[model samples]
Target: MSERGGPPQQPIIVRRVHRRGHGHHGGAWKVAYADFVTAMMAFFLVMWLIGVGTREQRAAISEYFRNPSLVPGNATLAPPGRMGPGGASDSAIKLGGAMDLPHGPGKDTRGAAAASVDGRTVEKEARRQEQARLQELMQQLRAAIQNSQALAPFKDQLLLDITPEGLRIQIVDKLNRPMFDLGSAQLKPYTADILRELAGFINRVPNRISISGHTDDAPYSSGNRYGNWELSADRANAARRALLDGGLQDAKIARVVGLAASVPFDKAHPGDPINRRISIIVMTRQAEAAALSQELADEDAAPPAATAGPAAASPAALPAASAAAAAAAPGVLVH
Candidate 1:
């Protein structure tokens, strides 16, 4: 203090108080918070979609999430330049076609088209061969029925026709000569002989068979449980047994059902004896696949508790869900 002439008697100390700006809650924290909110919103949106979607739709969505890069129509993330053979960017070669670029995106359009055409052609050929084989089978069945002494008398009751489903052979009930006892599932000796004769030819073919029973629309109320449904199903099962007795393998029976007057042969007269009949359909490959898919869908829709006992032992019953999925593919019957 004495060394300086201006400040003489006392030394003055200047103290500065530096105050920090309000608690530095930086923009980074805000950014993190915003990101969290956005992620939560997306999560909620995905949950809503899953809740409303069907099984197939849900599977598709799951697949998309698993690999978003593989989704169609997604823009390819690439630099605008030629990539060297080793995958390095080569700036020297500019991207140009004949007019403006050398080539389009790296896609094999010709190969894809060729593959699609080949697939369609193969399917067409398969269908044609299947049709021819089924036609030959139909002719053989007609000849066999006409030649058989056991089935010759009952020829008027048998109806054979080729349908999109394949060869359909229906044995209609006559007013005078019913196939079964009056209102019973028991088959007459003549009906059994006819079914057995058909089975001999049916077993020779690789195609699977679908058996169904139909009934007239008469009012039936025997007790509380027994009805036309049970009767019809029993009759179909009886026919299935007869076919097995005549050499048809159990695995060859693709479907056995009871229509119970729903699909009538004589629609004009629902109560006609002709409507009360048994139908055997040799399923085409396409028809069999479609029918199996439908059955699987129905089974998946049913509850687990309904898959047991005689009430559930109908032909409409499911095998295993895994079995259904494993069998689901476009082709002839695997067995």
Candidate 2:
């Protein structure tokens, strides 16, 4: 037969047969897979517990894992009436059999409570003594202001009051006599003299000092970059610098705040010259403790999470606006 005329060539046929597993390779791999899955589940559960549990709860869980016998009877796994090892009652289970006595947890808790009470009492007594000392110091400061030749001229501008925080002294502006130059944060010669005298008396007290700057309701203009808040803060910082220059210790000033017009000396007259002033407060021990606690709390807080957009930016971080509107905002200047 001719090759071309040969019957249609048959298509090539290929067969592939996959082999099955050998009989000897039994279910060993299945067992291993099961074990791996169980281990993973247990790991995930432990991670979840650690992530969600509080400090005390985590400590308790860790103790239980270290020594299962240490788990209290109140736990779901343990019976209520059962006693722990080493003859400890169910009410008290000392870990690792450390305590041989049968005393309950209540005894230790009571002792701790008593100690706390005693500590509070001692703190109270110490605070009372400090208040008395600060009171005496306030009187001395008033007397010194009245008697001192340099401070006498400014006495009319200075007002003294005893507040809950401690002694509060306010220095206010007069119609013709301002503490600072117009539209500047520079301390005048007389203002410096008054602050210098104040620093000398303030040094005699152990309490910390707090300085604040205030302004009238009249608007201020400092380009768009500066506003009332910035101006007030600058004046306060300027006052702080003057106090430090006048023999006051750097550590003595606890806070320098700028209230702007929030706290007006003359409440009925927001635009009054007296509303533009500087305040110095000698903080009481209790107030100081509270302030320190708040500071620590603020410091220990976590940073805010970042977000996309200008909305995430803080007001303090945002770019300044036009000064046209800021001209109406209250501000401070130290001359």
Candidate 3:
């Protein structure tokens, strides 16, 4: 319909609408982030605790976490599925069993224990026992020698010692009773008695013996062709024979060596009275003549070419030299 001189006007309608500025602050994301951080921290703490704790400590920890109420003060709860602090499950405490404790210091609760001994220790103990026995025997021998009127005079000249080789008894020559006559290798009467008593003592021992003769650095007379070397050897052999006759077994005599004046007893005083002596050595199991002979034979049987190379060349060239040079070389022969 038309009104107030206007072309066909429609009816007007009014309505009010309010626009909200922004939604209320949503804290759900913040809560989720805080929960994630707390979970990560708890996981790391558990890992650290596990790494440092022993088996027993770990079992105790599992019990504590599963059921705080299962602790000593709070034992009224049920065995399993009981509430812990903050209402968590108590299943871990009921399921946990006793754990093995760690070993303390000095406790060897492992496998079968060892014997705590070896070959070297046994050998050392045996050697110690042998040495003690030998020392006791030496004391007895010394007492016997001191009590004998015939051996008392020779006590000062005798030396008894325990060496690496074994027991060594040396009889040194003095001015009053020389072990042998001036130039001859004959033993005196009293010397023979003393040797007989020594032989009696040696017969009791089950070890091998070595008789060695040494001389002072005194040159022989020109008229006498024989030198100290031959005299020493003869004297040593004579002593061996006398010992055998005096009840010492021949099988126990290992070797008879004559060093002449090469190995002096007192090096500072080469011609000392002690240098002229007869040394009776009891050989140890290791230093026996048999072992030395075996070692020597092995050395000798090694390739002759390896041992003879340099020594053979000089002998081969000596055949072309003068006869006088060859003769002067002792064992050399000239063509």
**Candidate with best TM-score:** 1
For residues 20-107, could you state the per-residue lDDT of candidate 2 as single tens digits? 9896689888988999999999999989978986554565555444443333333322334334433334455443534444336523
Q: Score residue 50 of candidate 3 by CA lDDT.
A: 91
Candidate 3 per-residue lDDT, tens place, 1-335, comes to 66577788677877778866554466777988999999999999989979986554565556555544423322333324444344545344444332222234443211111112233446667777767766766787798779988788789888899876678788898866798888677888777778888888887767788887778888866464676767777788888888887888999997776666666677688777678888887766655744466546646865676664555533212212322443356422111
Q: Order of candidates by TM-score, top first? A: 1, 2, 3
Per-residue lDDT tens digits for candidate 1, residues 1-335, read 57666666766899999977675655777888999999999999989988976555565555444443311232232444323222333343444531122344554433454456656667888989888888898888778778879888888999998777788899999999999997789999998988888888887778888897878988668775666767777899999999988888888899887767656677699899998999898988888898889867777876687466555544322323322343354232321
Q: Cα RMSD for candidate 3?
A: 28.2
Residue pairs clashing, model 2: 180-335, 181-335, 185-334, 186-334, 186-335, 187-335, 188-335
Cα lDDT of candidate 2 equals 0.71
Question: What would the TM-scores of all predictions be?
Answer: 0.62, 0.60, 0.53
Candidate 3 TM-score versus the reference? 0.53
Q: Which is the winner by TM-score between candidate 1 and candidate 2?
A: 1
The clash numbers for all candidates, in the given order, read 5, 7, 0
**Alpha-carbon local distance difference test for all models:** 0.73, 0.71, 0.67
- After TM-score superposition, the amount by which residue 182's alpha carbon in candidate 1 deviates from its true location, in angstroms, is 1.2
